[model samples]
Target: MEWKPLPVGIDDFEKIVTGDYFYVDKTLFIKELLDMKGEVNLFTRPRRFGKTLNMSMLRYFFEENPENVSRIFQGLNIMDAGEKYLDHMGKYPVIMISLKSMKQPSYELAFEMLKKALKGEFQRHWQLVSDSGRLTDADQKRYLRLRDLEGTEADYADALKFLSECLCRCTGRKTVILIDEYDVPLENAYFSGFYDRMTDTIRSLFESALKTNESLEFAVVTGCLRISRESIFTGLNNLKIMSVTSQACGEYFGFTPEEVRRMLDFYGLTEDYETVRQWYEGYQFGNAEVYNPWSVINYVDSCRLNKNSLPKPYWSNASSNNIVRTLVEKADFSVKQEIEDLIEGKTIIKPIHEDITHEDMDSTQDNLWNFLFFTGYLKKIQEHQEEETIYMEMAIPNREVRYIYKNTVLRWFEKKVEQKELSPLYESILCGDTEKMGKILSENLMETISFYDYQESYYRGFLAGMLKNIGNYIVLSNRESGNGRPDILLKYPSVRGKAVILEIKVSKTYQGLEAKCQEALRQIEEQKYEEALRQEGYSQILKYGVAFYRKECMVKK
Candidate 1:
């Protein structure tokens, strides 16, 4: 069978349906929404999990387009629902806007981007202005200002509510409002030093559009994180939130196991099912195990073109992942242990705050964990409530996300080493100043994370990574040298005639740290670990032993 081109980045429902693109049928979502309609609904899921595409699907299904209703959704699951459901299709004036593009580096640019997006939405309904006879004079001026992209800050603040009222007046029907990535500007502002300004603007905008708007039939919003009600929603009594932990619409945003199996079978790639599952199929949405749709689709597309192609970390490649890195970098002792446990396939229980704002993230560690959980880096395995709080056991969602954590941490440490003034460390090593070396190493270790019991390989990796930029030396790790394998061997090939051998050990207590350092040096002497380097024409050789206990370290020469 010939395979249709994969809709890799296409988020438009009309394009996916009308073009030759493969689409997973999520039309039943419409029936579900109508059956359990809320005045205002908010759905929070991670990026690339079909949020945009699903919103687009909702727009195409309910927007006022009677001519193409049947043609667009001819054989979908929603059609099987009785006439009561199908009759509501394409019947309301719908307004859709995505704030994903509002992630600018500064507040001014971000606010402008928001204005530009609202302008486009207003222009979509330009008929309200062209046929001014339908609208009153006041609304006509408002529509013309917005349509011409000349609206002021106050004008754009109430843009959505104004658009809804005008559409209702002209068409004699209430309007359905759909906002995608609604928290994007808030996230950007939090990182760009403009959180307060952006929050005030967005809060006012949402208040006017969603709160007590008589023109609104219903509203649906999608975002990666659910901003706190007090922060943005602000006393909207009819608001309903369905997050990753919610059982309401969990299965709609991701691909179920049955869906993946059928998709692989359709493409004649069923043999690769286990490989795909191991990489992308551990996300637990409520009671269902769902796969990452972006990675799965990209994996299938790559395999079709090249059978031997391995599944790449496509999601990680797509994101800079600064948020995860920031959390990892600021990890205290307990947070570091939790991260290690997560990497070791163990779960840690953390209190979850479903309604968290970007500002709250920096103030509490639990909020950071909550952010990670909701953003798809971590998945909840078990949940229990005590008094008014909910605690969840979280772990890395899948092999793909675990790979992301490992690589991101390593890159962050490597970058840290590269940016530091390491000439002092090099000079100390060259001069055989073991005390200074130990002090510098200890200070550096204090700035990094350690996994307590998991210390030997961890310390060795840290040493190797920090020493990777030795000016003119070649560093080899765990290579067989003399009687046994030394931890690291730095060989200078120039006429400087210098070489260094390092052996690392870990202790359980601070008192034993010094003894462990001495023992390491004795091992270097007894095992003749430097014999190979001396035999390779190095006149002066430096042998150092390093011992670590948590963040403290001792060095001896």
Candidate 2:
């Protein structure tokens, strides 16, 4: 039997339903929204946790689309949620827009892109607004100006509110606004050096459209971070925020355990449930234990294509994932120790500042932890409220997120190694200064946070990264020698030039490092590791054995 195609990158509600793709039933999110009835609702979830699809679902359910009369929401949970909830369906005009595409390099460009996006939305509703006899000549011309992208920056700021009013006049019903990834511009601007300008522009847009607009029946805004009230949603007293930590709508964003199991069972992937849970489970949104929906879908799809494929980091590619990099790069001594502990599968406690804006992101270690917590890199295992501040115990969510962190830390370590003054390490290896070489090796070893369980391969890679920048000698890893592959080999260009061989080992304990180094040296000699270099006519050859026990190292020449 063939299975329904998984919606890999498709977020459109109509497309997913009409095209018969496999969709996790999140339609109940509509019932919850209508019941809450906030003037504005902001949902804070991670990047690929179905925020856009949920918003798209909302647009289809609430928007006034008379042409779609085949019951697009037929047989969903929302349909059985009682007629009171369904009564609001197809009753309001929707001003749907996604700010996610506004990730631009400059404020001018971001503003232009946003304006063009609004122009498309205007075109979507152009016929409705143009046919409204209640709309005056001035409003019609203004709508045309916005639809053609002929409006100035100031005119565009109030365009959303103005369009909502025009639609209200057309249908005698208020408009429901759905904005996806509303914080994208702010996030992009924060990193793009235009935060203040973008903030002001967004502030005006939200102020006119959400804060004081009478034409709005309700609005739902989805984004990753909940920008502080002072930063963007200033004075919007009616804005109800359901963040990842909020217990109200947690199950609607990511997949619950039962939902995931059923999805796995549907695709005959039930046997791989444990592996899937290990890699994708552990995220705690509210009190609901959930799996990364994006990763689960992609993994199930991969299993369909190739039954033996293993799960990898799927959500990491959906976003930049540089938050952890900034956290690791700017970590202080204590923070560095905490990070090392985290890499060792330990939990760290941090003050949970849920109300954070992009401006203060990564400014301090505490803020960085909050950013990581909300951005899905870390999972909230435990939490408590003390006085007024909330403290959370967070750990790496799963292997997939751990893979991201380890990769980031490895890259950061590699960059630090590249930035090191290799003249000393190079000189030590050349002049046979094993003392300086061991010291430098130990120092560099101590600086790296290993997630590979401190295996011999990790140390080998570390040594290779350090030696890769040697001025003249070329470094080769695991290259075939006379009788065996050397852990590392660095050769000078000329036949008369010097050569060096490095053999690496991992010790069980600190005291065993010296013995392991000796064993490595014995392997180098007994295996005739230097015979190939001698065959190449290198007159001088130096050999060293390197061993590591956790952060300590031993070098023997």
Candidate 3:
């Protein structure tokens, strides 16, 4: 029997339904949301945790679509709940906007993208102005300017609430507003140096539509990070925030354990469930444990095409995991220790703040931690309160996220090494200045956070990367030499200039560093590691043995 194709990368509700894709039922999100009856609701989730698709599903379920709105939601769980919920099916004139495309390099380009996207939304509901016998000539002209893309940026600022009013007047019903990735503009602006202007623009849009608009029945917004009310949401007090810290909508955004099992069973691949759980299922949202729905679906699709495909870090690769790198780079000594602890399958305690603005993200270490926790790099495993502060025990969410941390740490370390002046170290090594070499190596080690558990191979790679751009020298790692493999070899590409050999050893303790360095040097000589360099006609040679213990290193020549 053929299975329904998994909806990989398709977030449109109608497309998934009509295309016969296998969709995880989350329509009950509608029932729960309506029951709560929030004036304005905001959901903060990590990227690709089904926020866009859920927003799409919500938009389709509530919009005033006459043709096929109810048809797509048919036979789902929401339909079985009876008439009270079904009465809301296509009840309002819905306005949907995605700020994702507003991520531009400058405020001008970003606002243009916003205007273009808003123009499309206006065009979607042009019938409100054309068919609304209640619309005045002024309203029609206003709508026409937006529809025709002739409005100034200020005119488009409060477009949603304005559109909602016209929609209500035309249909004699209030409008339900849906905004997807609402923080995209804010995030972009903060990084692009135009944050205040973008903030005022979005603040106007949101306050008009959400805080002050009487025509709005309700609004739902989704984003990865929650900008504080003090920033973009200033003076908004009627908002209901449902984040990963909330138990209300925990199971809606991601596939639960039961859902994952059923999805695997549907594809006749239940045997892969354990592997799937290990890679994607450790995320804790509220009180429920759920898998990353995006990665799980993509992984199962891979298994369908090939039975032996290995699980990759699908979710991390989907969006920018730049937060991980930022955290790694900005970490001080204590912060570095915390990162090392988290990467080693351990946990660290930090006060959790859900609402963090992008502009002040790195102002304090705690703010950065809060950013990582909310953005899905770290998961809150335990929570406790102390005198007006809430602290959480956080860890890397799962192997996939851990893989992201490890990979980000390695890349940041490499880039850090590449940017520093390596000429001094090159000269020190050439002059057999073991004192300067040891000091430089140890200082560099003290600056980086190691997640490889201080492995010798890590140090070897670290040294190799540091030597990668030495003037006229080519760096090789673990390559076959005279009688055995050498850990690192720095040689002139043309072989007539000079060469250096390094053998790395990891000491069990600081006291053993000298002994380990001697052992490494003995092995280098015994293994004839310099024969390959000498055979290439280099008369001058430099050899050193390096031993590392945590952040301290000893170099012997």
Candidate 4:
């Protein structure tokens, strides 16, 4: 099979079009977007749901003097729309801006991003000034003045509206505005506690042009979360929201099941069908079943190189787990249980919503999980229509996301533990107070580590997290050996101190932990655990063995 240039990280229309790249024609959705005829439309989709590329496509199809829109869509599916569509393709004024860059922990940084985006759009329009045949001398002079302005610290909305009016006068056409990731700044603000300021900045900016301006032809806004109507839209009655939960435009955002099957067929990886489906094919959009395009494309790219490597995680690469990590940090009992079920790939019962209604939980742990589910982090495993509830299962969608979310949460909780007084536990262990160590281990480690029925790796990971709370340490699992490797080897390093080594084991039988610990010690000797530690320059290694009983873990000598 011939390998096509996967758009990979390219979201620019001119770059994708003028350069050689594989294009998935979604111009059909462009027709549908236009069919709605709403002056202002908001589309809320999860991260890496192709919002940026779709906006770029919109710019190619509508921008009057786009640098190279015609060439980009030359051989695309839009050609099937005939010359009528092709003639109108590059014939409208377009103000394409993205708020994705506006993501920051501070209001000042967000404002800087906003300024940069506006400046970029202004420069694009300014370049078209010479070709703007319809602009009067006075209008041209005003455009020149706006372009010549230096300080980026000025109000962006007024400048953007002035540019829109200038474009309308210059092109004799209303400007089509594409605002990608419109909620990024607001989402950041909400997450980081600058909510009011971001809301005020963006709400004013959007209202000025998106709501009141007559020079605007139509606008499309894409974001992960939907800012409430009362906050962003305000009295803008013309606004229409096309959310992931919407029946229409759902299939347009992500690749449908049929599309996935056909693409798999095209790539000749149909043999790995079930495995691929299990990982990336759980997302459902109303009646149409979809797979994450980000993951699918990445899987295809992987298969192109190695015939048997299998598709790894892709969606996780483009997303930040801050939202999920924040959710996990604040998770309640019910949410923790649900998360446990998800990690086990078991279905969890819940309601799916475009916007969750619970105020206390809206931005909290419970609703964040719901947000992740609806947005595609977790997929509905089973549905009970009679009860009006859905059973959802969660998985790290891609390899990148798996490590990211776990590592993010790991670091977060690690910082929390360090902030508190952890010296008592460390001191107790260092002093070799077996009694005190036993009590602390029983209390602290037991509840912290959870065991699954047949998940040896999970048990190891759980133990690792539990031990990490002790102090700076390295826990290695499942290392290679000639005969067999130890289950886990934990190393605790401290300045001016002797280090400790822990060998972990799982108790399959209901035998007492003392017997288990004795067997574990025997295995450690057989596995040459002492040699492994001595090679690291430790003259003496204090060995401790541990065993688990469901959620309760015990340390044995």
RMSD of each: 3.4, 2.1, 2.1, 4.7
Can you list the residue pairs that collide in candidate 3? none
A best-first ranking of the candidates according to their TM-score comes to 2, 3, 1, 4
Predicted structure 4: lDDT: 0.68
Q: Using Cα atoms with residue i matched to residue i, what is each candidate's TM-score against the true structure?
A: 0.89, 0.95, 0.95, 0.81
lDDT string, candidate 4, 441-505, tens digits: 55643333132443455556654554566656665666432346566555657433455655666
The digit string of per-residue lDDT tens for model 3 on 1-557 reads: 68679999999989998889998899899999988889899999888999999889988888887686778888889999889999988888898999999999999999888888889989988865577678788878888899888986767878888999989888989999999999988888887899999999999888888887889899999998878898878778889999889988888988999999999999888899889988898888888898999899999999887878899999877878767777888888999998988888999999888767887787888988888888888888899999989999988888999999888888998888888987888899988999999999888888888787888767877788778888877878884334487788888877677888888889999999999999889998898888877888877888888999988988998
The global Cα lDDT (0 to 1) of model 3 is: 0.87
lDDT of 2 by residue, 93-146 (tens): 999999877998888889888998899888999888767677888888888899
Decide which is better by TM-score, 1 or 2.
Answer: 2
User: What are the lDDT figures for the candidates, one per model?
Assistant: 0.86, 0.87, 0.87, 0.68
Q: After superposition, how far is residue 503 of candidate 4 from its true place, in Å?
A: 4.9
**Which is the better candidate, 1 or 4, if ranked by TM-score?**
1
The candidate with the higher TM-score, 3 or 4, is 3
